[model samples]
Target: MVERKTIFSYLPHLILLIGIAVVAFPVYVAFVASTWDPATISNGQMPLRPGPHFLENYYQTIFVGTSRTTREPVGGMMFNSLVMALTIAIGKIAISIISAFAIVYFRFPFRMTAFWVIFVTLMLPVEVRIYPTYKIVSDLGLLDSYAGLTIPLIASATATLLFRQFFMTVPDELVEASKIDGAGPMQFFRDTLLPLSITSIAALFVIQFIYGWNQYLWPLLITTRDSMQTIVIGIKKMIVTQDALTEWQIAMATAVLAMLPPVLVVILMQRLFVKGLVETEK
Candidate 1:
């Protein structure tokens, strides 16, 4: 027999649709603004629908650098952001997983102490430690570089704790079986743990990638050159304090472009990301 629906059953779907509309409306407006000319947007004459200048505004935003606030093209900024995001995501995963594996598998002195230390770092985020971290990075000549943008932010104590928790849930029988099959620590990790951790990795990668992409304060402090700016920073720079001088259409286009990468990442990894979050048993 088919299950019957009720008014209550439809409430959640209705709520979700409302939430989607609330979130998407601004983005839709931004896209429309991006397609219009600066005068239309500035004079508040922009229509809800897209304009014919989509190609011109986007081409100028992407390739031909903006006129007033930032002289660097959005393309270069996007590249900088992509590099920083990928490096941070991959670096955090590699470091956290290895740290978690050692803390879980190997029996060493202060093992729990080490794990607690890592966990404690969750309380001391980058903002809390920005001063000393910036000093070190500056002294090391990493300012205005990709390393400066990512290294200080890549440790990810939260990811380490997550991996540690996941590793603990793994059955000891699997470890014994791996040993019996002539697999060493590295071999077992490489062949077994890595495969098992794929979903978790994807989940963390998405989180960290967005974290890196949206970074503004740290990148702002470190990067002095226009060429080294990320897309988020580029958006900020494009909208000058002087309203007339600011290229509204170009800024809106840049804003729309800035959102594309992270959105694409989440879309592509939606499956693994959801699995990693909700999956409990191995």
Candidate 2:
């Protein structure tokens, strides 16, 4: 038998429900607005209830796009976003893990100094370094390319630190046992270390993917061609005009679509992310 809850016990649940509604109200309104005609939303009298044009609005946003301000389809933009996001995530993980492995396993002079220098980068915001980074990317002839979009953002100090901390937790006994079995350091790392690092890699991948996908300023400045535009950056072009003729329905639909990938990533990987975080901290 279950014990009945008193009114005071329900207070916390009530508060949480209220909080969820407060945050979700704007998204609900956007979803509602996306189902209305441009004229309906343009009048600012859009209904609270679901309108009949939801499917058409989404279809146009994905395939046809809001062409008044931008001609590129949202489908292409989403593809570009996915590419950038995955590239950043993979690049960060690859480099960070290697750097951490080198730092933890090898005893080189000035190793701590090198580690500190890399760690110091965490304090610097991307905005602070954008001008120099832009100049370098321009000089390298990488502008308007995927490399320009993802490379400059791939050096992740947080991921490196996380991996370094995790590496320190691996037992010295494992190294001894592997050596006794005639396994080289590289061979041991390939089999033992990588397997143990899976949860951390998954968690970091999610973080870096979100970071790359949501990048607006850098992509906006670097990408001159419409074909290179990311969904986050391209959405701005859709709202350039404040007039009633602007496609609010299409814009709202696109906004909803833009939010789906990151949300789904977190929801799908919730268990892995939690485990990775907890273990990493330990």
Candidate 3:
């Protein structure tokens, strides 16, 4: 209480409150809208108050979906999203950590050259290489499969860079000590590096999970099969009519449902995520 006496101290809280409102307001509106039917919202006179059909609307959206479009269950879409998010999160961590370790610990021919080549990928967003990615996946016959859905998006230049930089900050004494104890690189990596990297790994998992969950474009592009469609893409199908006929209530419900897992992940890993950001930079 004493620390918060000054107006300066309250300024940060005020700013944060404003930021929270800015972010939460849309979600709140969606929740409100999801509780109402089309006729109630279509007149452009929707109430901020909760409507009576909230449970029914959500039940239909999750289990039955819309009769007008898609009609695929939201439960299935959620499951697909979960699988893709987990796959991408785990895959990126595995790929990035190994790449980071090799780049940091070993001395080989064109080592820095390889690092630079990997780093250069950060300059090229997926949109730029979408065609090439599609071609490769198609040639490999992975389209519409889980591998096709996730493998293409699993590469993360930023994650590799973070791990590599963090690895550099690790004391060389640990490496020497391990070698003196007759521990090989793999042994040291498994025993020491992984233990030390729990925070970083948790933080990356939180981030990459959200990234994978919110992926609309790549999933939409690759997954032609309704059964493989992720929640984010499934939401788009609700608006197929694009007018008042578009079931805003179900769409809003779907949006709210889609937000849950990532929100829960961030909330649970909040401390580790912040710590990882600060530590990895140092």
Task: Choose the strongest candidate by lDDT.
Answer: 3
How well is each residue in 139-193 modelled by candidate 2, as lDDT tens digits? 9999999999998888878888899998898999988898999998799889889
Ranked by lDDT, the better of candidates 2 and 3 is 3
| Candidates, ranked, TM-score | 2, 1, 3
Worst 10 residues of 1 by lDDT: 273-282
Compare the candidates by TM-score and give the number of the best one: 2
- What lDDT does each candidate get? 0.88, 0.87, 0.89
Q: RMSD for all candidates, in order, please.
A: 2.9, 2.5, 2.9
Which lDDT tens digits does candidate 3 get at residues 49-164?
A: 88999999999999999878888989999999999999999999999999999999999999999899988988888898888888898999999999999998888888899898
lDDT of 2: 0.87
Instruction: Put down candidate 1 lDDT per residue, 185-268, tens digits, no spaces.
Output: 999999999999887888777778887888988998899899999989889987777788989888899999999998887788
- Model 1 lDDT vs. the true structure? 0.88
Answer with 1 or 3, whichever has the higher lDDT: 3
Error of 1 at 163 (Å): 1.1
